[model samples]
Target chain A: MKKDELKKKRIIWVIWLVILIISAYFVPFVLLRGINQVEASFLYWTVFAVAAILSTIKITTYWSD
Target chain B: MNSFYVYLALSIYVLIGFYIAYKSRQGMKQGVIEYFLDNRSTGGIVSALSYSATTYSAFMMIGLAGFTYSGGVGALGFELIYLAGLSLVAFFGPRFWLVGKKYGYVTPYEMLGDRFQNKWIAIISAGTACVFLIPYLSVQLMGIGYLMNGLSGGEIPYIVGVIIASILAISWAVIAGMRSVTWTDSLQSLIMIVVSVIILFYVIYTQLGGFVSFFGRLETEYSNFLSVPGPGFFNFQTFLGLTLPWFFFSISNPQVSQRLFIPKSLKAMKTMIKGFLIFGLVYTLVSVLWGFSAKLLFPGLQQADLATPTLLGSEHVPLLLGLIAMIGITAAAISTVDSIMLTLSSLIVRDLMQSRDEYSDKKQLRIGKFVIFIIAVIGIIFASQQLDLIATLSVTSSVGLMIVVPTIFGAFFWRGATAAGSLTSIILGAFTALYLQFGNLSPLGLAPGVWTLIITVVSFISVSLFTEAPKKKANEFLGYLDKELEDKNIL
Candidate 1:
């Protein structure tokens, strides 16, 4: 956890984070195309739930010692 | 007009609220940490749910429904920024909590006061919180009244509804202070999630026939509603208006800051933030779908704000829908009212009631309860104005929190920021928000939230850089910042 390495790691993590956020913008349309309202809502929420869990892991592992 | 049951249900709800408050009084704590931040004993589930309940209120369901129905769905882009705002807030939670613990910074203004060595800034901030929060609080009262009147078949008067609602909210705030609000919010959050799911399912079933039919129907019947704001709906100004100020506001708001102080560990902080993000995404999608259903079912409604409850109350749904709608509205209103009351109570007691070191824990708790009672009375008076709940709410909150951008940024980033810089920003931001909201003076039809942010930022930056930084408290201020962060393991 030297200064340069820490800075480099943060930059890489931030880049991936941006990609994840952009991907989320398309989630509603993808899920909404399904046949039933309940199914669609469940699908959309599932994607959201997964993303949240992934981000939480990334934050903890990266930011916290 | 089968609104009689709405009134009866509401009456029973308020009575339960009073009982909860009365019951929680026995458990009131004598320590500051115990009273304000729940002794950091709040579990993950309770913390997550309380955050969601406090974050999304009648403002989200009723108020935002009006905005989407009238302003179109493109306006929902504002919500996307919230995902980022909330997540960032979560990330910063550990740092803020650590700092708060080290310096005894219970309220947001305490941080400001310590940063600038200026008590006036804290006083102004606490004052702004009180003034802006009352109208916002009134909106919750009005929403309760609306539900009561709509449900009771016009049997219960709006004034009685207001009193019943206020007393219930004040009672809750009084007994537990933050502790009761946290547990009650957890309970309310569960109710909101269940009711929200039920409404989404029923609306999709009755209106669109099913999931497949809903999207197909949306494409054909409400194509414009689903499209992103581009052609005539969104412009550069609107995009700037909706997104930028909201990002700044979310981080700076006192209620959100209060959340940052509650978590005990970094892990707890991350979980809470992630929970809120998921909640925001689900809640927005379900609420928007409900609004779209409103569009199709009642094409010629006078007010778009009433669309959700009206559609729920329509004969197509069951008696259960009416009951859930009543509870959903109540859940949203109570969650918001409780949080606002907590914020108002803290601001009055900690920042205004006594000098910083002179205040005792017991005295602060007493003053907090007293402030809650005062706010409840004022909210009742405001609810009698015959204004729509959402409009009054947005205008008032916009005016009150307009200083958030400058004040918070100045605190964290601007090393050269001065008391005068904060003062000018507060004065300019408040005036701009007030003029746009009350005097109809948003420059070239801009949203007041946007106008205020711009004014505050310009004033704060210009004043800070151009003028000399104060010499008196420079070393002490730096020491405070260093000590606050070092102890918290932030850096």
Candidate 2:
């Protein structure tokens, strides 16, 4: 609940998001080449859905400070 | 393919639009701020819906669906990357809202101009927005025209559709400005989601017999439609090229970024962000599904843009549902066009005019309305040109607007960023993007978008490094923001 804590939390989220984005960009290509189309799409969507959910949580919690 | 049905549907939509416009005008005071931004009184739902509606134009159903149909799951990945890019919103939304509220900023460029302490920064940014967004708005109008004409089997002329779209766009914005646009956009967003959901269900259950069967068909019959480089389109580089500009869309696009200032409270803004993300996710899924369904039902369509229309007119889709889908597409295009028109008008009146003393609030509102009319007329003229695919035009506009990204980031985050750097980046970057696009030349096979972004960043940073920084003003602005964010507990 401290300002420093909140800043740290936000920083963590930012780092997570950057990692997620990079993965989202490249994972599909790797998946498509290595796996079946359905598997690749499913993996891609799962990652995207997780990212979307994390974003929603991050926005909703931003005001908690 | 009854022209009468299309006309009836459009008439009903127009009547509803007029009713919404009239209601939006109630209790509305006539002033520049009130007219342009609804006096910053917009609530969360309207903000979210307007943002979603404005962001997802007819491009989603028509262009994106077609992209998926031709380019495969890379379309979904491209759009998801865009959704992922909304992380920038989470970072910048609070900063924008606090600054706008504190400074009473009317347009996004106003914030930039004030932050940089250079009116030319504002003017140039506004000019860049106008140059790119006008063509973008024209594409929205063209989408409606093509949809109506295609649905009617050419019983209605494309020009008629263009005229109708122009009229609707003008009336919606001119009638009540942001209030009317936001209200109608809310309705349109709901219609867009609902209709797409219904159509998705119908396609999956009725036509394809369910999700498993749908996937089975995709795997067994159309496996190429589910991965990158499938059917030789949407290669990794091409997909990156197309999506790179869109990744920064929330900040680069003035219309959507301006909405960051509209929610009446931080809580409301939170609601808006969450709501829009949900809407975007579901709508995106529905659009991609529509594309996959089209691939299964109607294969070998010469034009990728024809995917949506062909699916809607196919034997499986009910005529009534198809008609409703047509309305939904029209709503998407009009909602987006009207928002762009309003934003452009604001940029012209507030940022470019520079002499606010010359015009009263009443006079400013009038000028804004007049600009909207002129923009609509110009958009109609451009739409009549019947440009290339909607997706291409839409991406080109985003790439063109991407030149402003460095300037915006500098305004918000970088103190060392100078006005000289911002201006140089925008001017040179915009020219580079335009030349590459027009000349059909991509350096080293990289997209114009990537090239523009790289050049713009290099110019922005290197110039700022060499130039003097606005230390005092930067401290004042950023200091105030830090204090406000802390005081408001908005971090």
- Which candidate has the highest lDDT of all? 2
Q: Which candidate is the best by DockQ?
A: 2
DockQ of each: 0.14, 0.49
Q: Tell me how candidate 2 scores on lDDT.
A: 0.86
Tell me the lDDT of model 1 at B260: 77
Error of 1 at B437 (Å): 3.1
Residue-by-residue lDDT tens digits, candidate 2, B1-491? 89999999889988998999889999998888788888888998899899999999999999889988888888888888898788788878888988898889999899988888889988988988887888888888877878888889999999999999999999999999999999999999999999999999998999898998998998888777676667768787788888889989998899999998888888778778888888998898899989989988888899988999999988889999999999999999999999999999999999999997588998888888899999988888778876664334555788988888998888777889998998899889988887888778888989898899999999999999999878888999889977766666554
Candidates' lDDT values, in order? 0.68, 0.86
Candidate 1 lDDT over residue span B1-491, tens digit each:
45556656666665665565566556556776677777766666667788888878776667566656665554455555555555456345665666676677788787777677788888888888777778777877888888777666677677777787777677667676777777777777777777877887887886679878876776666565554442244344565565555554456667767877877666677677667767777777667666667777776778878887677668766776678667777877887787888887787777775474687787777777777888887788788875654355555574458585676666665678888888889988887777776765558777777778778989998998887766456555555655544443333
Poorest lDDT segment (10 consecutive residues) of candidate 1 chain B: B227-236
